[model samples]
Target: MEWNERIAFVRKAAGLTQEQLGQLLGVTRQAVSKWESAQTVPDAVTIARLCEALHVSADFVLLGKEPEPPDNAGDAPPYALPDTCPCCGRPVSGTICPVCGYTLPTTPPRGPRYAIVASRVSFVNEEDRAAELVKYCGMPESYAKAAVHQMQEYASFFLLRRNLTDSAAQWIAAHLDGSCFSLRIVQDNGEESNDALLTKPKAMELPAPAAPKQGGLGFWGVVGAVIVALLILSFF
Candidate 1:
């Protein structure tokens, strides 16, 4: 059966009418009808919500593929469906959370890290700028002072710092004046390496071509001189 038919089958198995499923998914009944009739396909986010509402996996909904049974099924404990989504605190009864579409992580959660990058910056008093950084960006006074000093010296594209928390990066991007400083936040991949924004490097000056060696006689001149000396010796 097609994906649309699969959606219909799952909805019926879950004892949900089209209107009820629409209400659960925050969509109109007509939208659900279109999905069942194969007139329109739901977007990724809506499909995720549909999976949650129907208590089915995406593979089953989209590809009609049933989940494989675990190899040690007899030894495993029965999995219980959650009553509410932990992320958004919304009512749900599936492995996938409907409100935030959160699923149980198979791996350990990595803390997100962010970086603040500056493309341009205006001249400001160091003390005032340091104070602003401290107050607005949640930067330490000493670090803020050092950052301001670096900005003054560079006056071009440069990274403020990496390994910052998301809130701090957002605060720096939001609170800094746009005209004075073009700031952006970049999320790091939980690595210790510093990633800088792309920027054009200064054009390097090439040394001027070396002037031709001064006062060097031509090969023809040397040959002519040798012939002249031979002639003069013969005459002598």
Candidate 2:
């Protein structure tokens, strides 16, 4: 492909809008649009920036082939963790792309509630869970009522991180043993919402090597146990 075509291809493949690319490149959306349309081309400096942002070699952008790495520390391990979404080329280790909601093709299919057996909990609606928290944790009635929304906001950050970084996936795996939290939206008709992240999983970023176990639960597992312990205590 021509350089113009190549630029467009890499940008879209990188899961960046023209505006986003322009923002990264210190140009206007119009300029990026013009470049993709072949009305103009990026200068040498811009080309360098594009390569760095995309984590691709200049040769690949210019000639569509990545040159071989040197036989030294320069060469990355063949099985190094993914820093970008394979589908959209956006960096993410989450089950789905945050930018385009592209699920990893390799992620396994899931049912209504998919979680690691150890990490798995009952799929209660947020309202019910909030009520339980209030009653069980002895939290302020108002605070308990509003907890779900607050947690959801925090969850959004987790979701976004899941979408943009593979690190989320690794942490989930190492801690939960492949058990990841999924929220389901139940419709009045008794059907689950059609969101893929809720029902079907997408490509997940694999975690790096885990630390040595201290003969106990992982970090999240311990946290979960503490929550359960608190709930149990509240009953008394």
Candidate 3:
């Protein structure tokens, strides 16, 4: 596809309108329209901004191809030894720092640990759920949002099953940061529900959750089913 088509495709895929993309780029909607119409091409800086905003690579936008991976894609950073401690800012070499006595961590920090739990409750969007997590669980806002999204995509199948509440709880617990932070999924039983697709993990480190062929029961579908079941139980 051409650059214009790629821009339009990515923008729509990201759930953004021309005006929204314009606002994000600090340009007018007409400007975005022109770009999408192939009347004008984004400059180098604007192209970079576009890539960042759309969460895509420049190569994909320009050539419709994923960028080639580096030869040492999975290798560690080129430099060795402690240039400075990430915690204390003291410089040292050859293992533990003498001044701070802090040893380098075995694995890189993957943000704060969190666990989510879902009962037979109404579905909540990730944004609101993220806010609740930060408000009640004392989680970092960015981390909470990302983690909520990850949980949703991987566990939507489990989320829809009323009898599998225990399984959902177990899944969350297993993924929680066992060392320091205790991220808990607080149940939100509000009336409103959404049917939006959850954001996917950018790169898969492990296998994805086994969901139904139809992309798991949508949030709204689950909500409707739960409400009907409740009504039936009440009538009985």
Candidate 4:
């Protein structure tokens, strides 16, 4: 193709319109149009700008020459992981297969892992709270039930599970927060600080019983006197 045609090709390949190309090159659309129509040619400085903007070598644009690949280009192996997991045959994310836990041998070492801990819940019953844990945190029903029971009965906080990726942990924490679970993310080693604690709903406290009014017959006082009179009558 002629150099003029090459300009049009590269501009279209870069997904830029004539006006957009002109904006990048600090020229008018009419100038870009004229260059494409062979009515004018870009000078050396403008050609350099065009090459930079279009990401094409000057030889490719001027002499229709394709850039040569590096000598060791073919020596490099292709990507080690497939678009889908080989074991589960499902689409995968990051380095690990979330479905079947299939990990690529060539995958790089991951960053710090995380663990999610449960502290409290707005739900009234342990079953409902356990269901929320299972839904949001993806824990098994048995494990979730046990965790909820532990959090409710014996512990102020329960370690739901550990060894989670950063993204997975964040996602679980957000969803648990949305579901009214008081939770926190900590390192896989189970270490946590006050700053790492997410919002935890305060445990509901029962109101203290009111003191009886002095010199007045309260309902309980009347019931107590009636019980004494019945005891005396029974003795008679």
Specify the highest-lDDT model's number.
4
lDDT of 4 by residue, 121-161 (tens): 55577887777666555568898888777766754677655
TM-score, every prediction: 0.32, 0.33, 0.32, 0.35
Over 87-128, each residue of candidate 1 has an lDDT whose tens digit, in order, gives 334455544443333343323334676666665467556787
The C-alpha stretches of model 3 lying farther than 4 A from their native spots are 67-236
lDDT of 2 by residue, 63-168 (tens): 5665785577445444433555533355654333434333344333233322211112332465665553343223455775465455545543111121322333
Using TM-score as the yardstick, the better of models 2 and 4 is 4
Q: Which of 2 and 3 is the better model by TM-score? A: 2
Show pairs that collide, candidate 2: 91-164, 92-164, 92-165, 92-166, 93-165, 93-166, 104-203, 116-179, 170-207
Error of 3 at 48 (Å): 0.5
- lDDT rank order: 4, 1, 3, 2
Quote model 2's TM-score.
0.33
Candidate 2 Cα RMSD (Å): 19.4
**Top candidate when judged by TM-score against the true structure:** 4
Backbone clashes for every candidate come to 0, 9, 1, 0
